[model samples]
Target chain A: MIRAALTLFLALATVSPLWSQSDLKKLSDSEITAFDSKLKSRSQATETLIADFRQEKSMEMLKNKMVSKGVFKYKREDKIAFLYSQPMVYHMIINGQKLRILSNGKNQIIDLKNNPVMREVRTLIAASFLGNLSQVGTTYKISYFDNKGGVVVVVVPQSRQLSSVITRITIYFKGSNAEIERLKIEEGSGSVTEYIFTNQRINTDLTDEDFRIN
Target chain B: MRISGLISSILLVVSLAGCSPLLKEGIWLQNTPFAAGNVPYVYDTIPSTQIFDFTLVFKKSEVTGIVIIKTAGAGERRIVMTSVFGMTFLDFELKGENIKINYCIEQLNREKVILLLKKDFEILFKPDHSKITKYLYSSPDRLDALEQGNGITKTLMKFTNYNNKWPETIQIEHPYLRLSLLLKKTEYDPESI
Candidate 1:
């Protein structure tokens, strides 16, 4: 009887780690669902979001040379403007039907109806700008972490196609509120873009006419 | 006889005037063929070693930045390009006919640029015999005609209309940014010491 009890205790000890792992997984799933619920609720409450963004892009030339920097602006409902101030002066605006690029007093308009790449980029930016966090689950495997201030959501792309370009994206919020503090996107090619939001004014009087490509 | 001689002189002057502009235009286009040899070198033999500097300007939307490229290659061909601010962007190797573009920014749609550059480089150095023959034969006849003019030379041809040479100055007239690049101060080191 003593030998049998000792054998049973050893078997239980060996199985404990597996049980703990399953429990941890269950906890992670619950956290992810809760995080999704929080984002969905916040997005539903907000009407619109607008912010100023700075973008830096690096290009490799010939061997191992890199040069990068740029700035842009983002508004709610797929309105974006980019201005490159270095090397040259160029401006681009993506409105509803057209993508307009103005440089050297010349305007070139590309109809976005047939441009697949532009459509994809626009969709990605619009989804993020509108705070459609639930749609993010379609493309990414999301994990959530709760800290003192708010929630930190790390989104890793699920599809191989998405993962080939973007490795992960991290978004930070203030408390359980839907207000986002920052977003960082890391690419598989060892590039990162971080956007910090400040002085955010939600639902201020903004007209659709403001997005005209002038 | 005097009337006939005077008419002949006037006709000669008019003909000369007409021919002068045509000759000048011919010389202009000959001196600057829009696109010429792919790489900087003239011969088909790939050098054992090479070093050069390049400046690239990109205009997207309303933003513009200058990128400087410095390259040094040895053995099979290893290239290291850096920006003017000393940021290493791309490092790759080219062994014989194979090219490997090691690093590129993911956000930028630059795959086409890389493939084009690789093809151009291949054409520039160690050109295939058939392609070279086709290029020599099928090149624009206007360029061929311009080559006959006295102003253009094999060593150096200056363009009066556009202030740059082949493989040095690239003109990109985009809707967003019209860029003119001057590839200045080039040196070629051929010996592999």
Candidate 2:
């Protein structure tokens, strides 16, 4: 009886190791599925965000030793405008396919097809504003955590060119609504651009006249 | 033949008579050369913050340029500047050595602008021996004739007068644009600020 008991005990111990390994594998697979589901849910949640955002940008250049301030406006996926009020007067407006840049009271209209970088930047901003969080993941490795006021999303670029210019981008989401409170872009060359958003309104009526290039 | 020879002789005598006054005076017949010695030298140890509007114009063929600086002080320096046009270019505040320049427009060649501005400032304030040599060699007689209290303007004016080359008139020749500038006026007063 003692010999039989010893053989059974040894067999059980060997089988137990295999059982635990398979159990861990199953747990990992389920965890991955849950994570994917969570990502999909978050992406879906962001799809309903359509609004006008006001951004105040601060630009710093090391050689120039100046801190520049500018205002940025974005409406949905189509229109955007950047205005610099100090040192010089400069304005750029992009409404759909048409882009107009006014410098020193002279206006220049540039085709959007040839300017891929501007298009990409505009798309990135649009995507973020529309809550296409998954698209951001395609361009950036994103990590999120809760902060004192809201959620903080940190994005690190996946592309070499983007990574070269921008080291990291931090987005602060206000409240539970995921409205961007602030966006900070830090460059590899020690230049930084900080944008603070205020007085954001979603689905408000913005006319086509408001986006006129002039 | 004798009559023609007599006519020629009379003409030569008339010409010699006209030239006699210049020979007696032993000076150029046009005018006495204006001396630059009468101008007064004015120096001010201005706070870097006092400079408001700054412009730099380079020679067309050469890399050298003259920098024009203007300032407004209402307790502190608030500088406003533009390029050739009244197009506002850079705005900055200076506290001691710390200078802040904010660009009004973003250009593709921003690095070039920054570099040119840096070089301009260095030429303006820094005591560079090589620059002094270059300035002197460009107008050797001007420096030689530079009298005390004449300052840079008198030296420049004399150089322009003698060489017919205005070193202060800067020209910038580039592939895209050619720029020429003449320094119209300059005013500096530390006590007023």
Could you say which candidate leads in lDDT? 1
lDDT of 2 by residue, A36-95 (tens): 344444444442222323332222311222322355566655787766554445566787
* Off by more than 4 A, model 2: A1-72, A84-89, A111-117, B1-193
Candidate 1 residue-wise lDDT, A1-214, digit = tens? 9999999999999999877534432226776576667666666655555554443333323332222224445566677655545434556678876777665566767777754334544665566556665574576676666646476766787767557656777777776565777666666555455655666665655565545675
DockQ of each: 0.08, 0.03
Q: For residue A18, what is the lDDT in candidate 2? A: 64
What does candidate 1's lDDT look like per residue over B56-117, in tens digits?
Answer: 44453222223233233422455544332222345556666677766554444377556444
Alpha carbon lDDT of residue A141, candidate 2?
79
Error of 2 at B80 (Å): 17
**Model 1 lDDT vs. the true structure?**
0.47
**Which residues of candidate 1, in runs, are more than 4 Å off?**
A1-48, A56-75, A83-92, A96-98, A103-118, A159-162, B1-98, B103-116, B119-169, B172-193
Candidates' TM-scores?
0.48, 0.45
